[model samples]
Target: MSAHTNPPAPFAGVNATWIYTLGSIVAVYVLLDLLIITDLLSSFADTRSRGMLALVLVSVAAAATRIRYCWFLRSDSGSGLPHIGWTIALFAPAVISWGIAFVIPEGSFFAAVQLWFSGVLFALVASRRLRWWLILLALVLTLIPILVSGMAGDRVELGERHPATVLITIYSLVLPIMLISSLWFWRVVARLDEARSLAAELAVTQERLRFAADLHDIQGHHLQVIALKAELVERTLATKPEYAAEQAGEIRLIAKEAMEETRSLVSGLRDVALRDELENASEVLTLSGAACTLEISSLPAGTDAQRVLAFVVREATTNILRHSNATEASIALAPARGGFELTVKNNGVGEEPGRDGGSGIAGLRARLADVGGTLTADAGRPGAAGHRSFALTAWVPEGGPQ
Candidate 1:
């Protein structure tokens, strides 16, 4: 048999989830800034309001770029140098807003705080060495304008001693730390997912190697002895015909024994218990972030049908891992139609073409056929949320294959 290559990473959906969540957080922060900017725009002259609008737009672009970079980081697919233009865009809003505060000094406090939040959001994508520096710079830049405006005898109430100024300052200092901490936690999760994928692949490879070793042990000595006996038979045939015939008989017996042993080895390998398979499937799905439910009862052991059903469960687990973004899964085994029925279901049916018609399911159907069993797979209609479900069912006679 050809060796199995590692399947695609099972964490693509997980990564997409984290990416969407991160983007949502950034979007909320941007929306809050836009609200503040809208208020500021009404109080300012047209030219300054236009500048503020442009600043907000540039900041939005920078936020999008940050999310993109975070995705690239998580996927480990980024190449070439980081875009210089995005870094400039990220800082431009804060710089321009600070410039406005220096000139006009009216309503600079809120405007500076909102733009600083945008700067911090984008700075999260910066390199480790630069990220903190950029954030600190944002804090210093924001505070300077607010303090200068207050000290300049403006009634903006943004002085070093004002309650609002102190609170905003503390928030500006702490918010970046909080955002960075959250991103750091997310990065750790991505790494853990990567490690889990590697562990799973390694386990598969190790099992294959072990099986190969066992096969070699089973056949190696038998083949060697058969070769030696054949050589003896070839030599004795020229001089002692009766002895050669006896040796030939021994060779035939040895070959038969080898065939039986090989068959027994293969059967033993295939005879996985149904209950064990269900437990393993549940554990695997739960580890992959799916909630797995098992509704199974004890079945009699050492039956061909039981073995085949166990194999079906194993294959279904593999399919669910490789082909679906399932958040919930269930495996049910019960009596139906004078036999045992096994059903596996999941909510997140992916859009992989020919999923039900794929080679994996076809091979499964062939196996079930050998045991006088039937297998059916369906991608059920999507729900109101547009999330499709998939179900795989297998049925086998109680007395095993006829």
Candidate 2:
């Protein structure tokens, strides 16, 4: 299946929901660690060991940083190797916890679990490489400490009685399970991100193709009519000057109409009517899970201001869909202080991670300025419930600049 049509997978992207979920999980772990640390969970000496507490805190910190880095990585263009700093940031926690696990007073189930979790975390980050050999190498590295702890056991006992046996067995199961699970999780996320990007590019490509096809059809049809009319005019010119003149007039009319049609097609591609644009915007917003309300009293079919305002509606709708998780959106157009006002408003305005003010609004502003129009984008007045909204407002005079 194409990536765009693929069903949504769990943890597919580092969205707000994923961030909150991860934070909640970390909080729960922190709470559990605190209880264990204060001897509230259990009175066993090993359970409340200072070393275990240190390991738990470090592990949690490491996991949080690793997840944060992964989230940042997802926003990147997914080209070239990921920054070495992220690799260090992600790997450091796992390695440190490994050392702590090795030095625990004695091998315990909790230590085994911590070691396993660390291994899995490493795998999740490393899976970004999407290389099987590298993952295998990571698995080997994860196993080294477990091996070391096992071999460090006293030699007096051999076979089943060895301290290393239980440690080895626990890790033998833990390492593979965590490694496979993490590998699958990261792979799914990578694929989902790749699919999302490809889908966007494909949409643009298809639009370009459609535009090319339309241009070809329109030009070809007009050229054919012009060629046939020219032949008829040539045939009549010799026998009847009047007939030739009449044909010539027809030719001129046809040529003029064709030129106008071509220009109209080109302009219409860029500037649709405000009413049509509103309908399309509403459909797109609704498809994207936003409830849309359009409040334009009346939109003239072929006015200059309508064309410019239509472009604004198109751009603002695109930004709302691509950049926000808005649940509701509203667009309104009305007469204002000697001019027309167009505004697109939606909730869920916030800075996108890893992006500055996007080029859409900036480019829209420049376009409006070229036509003696003004564009304003800002946080809207807070609602009674103090909900934040982002609004894009534009004003164009009765007629566009002369």
Index of the highest-TM-score prediction: 1
Instruction: For candidate 1, report its TM-score.
Output: 0.54
Highest lDDT scorer:
1
Models, CA RMSD each? 21.4, 22.4
| Candidate 1: Cα lDDT at 65 | 50
Q: How well is each residue in 1-402 modelled by candidate 1, as lDDT tens digits?
A: 798887655446556657655765666555554555465555444446655565445445544554444443342222333567655655565566566666656656765675577567656655666767777877777778778877888854335323345544565667776666666677677788779899999999977764654355345534654665677788879899998898789779868966886787676643445686688678767756689999986574437787678767767776777677899999999888878899999998766337555766676687788888899888888776666898999998877776
Measured on C-alpha atoms, candidate 2 has an lDDT of 0.59
Where model 1 places Cα greater than 4 Å from the true spot, the runs are: 1-13, 45-81, 155-171, 269-402
TM-score of each: 0.54, 0.38
Clashes of each: 0, 0
- What is candidate 2's CA lDDT for residue 9? 62
Model 1 worst lDDT window (10 residues): 72-81
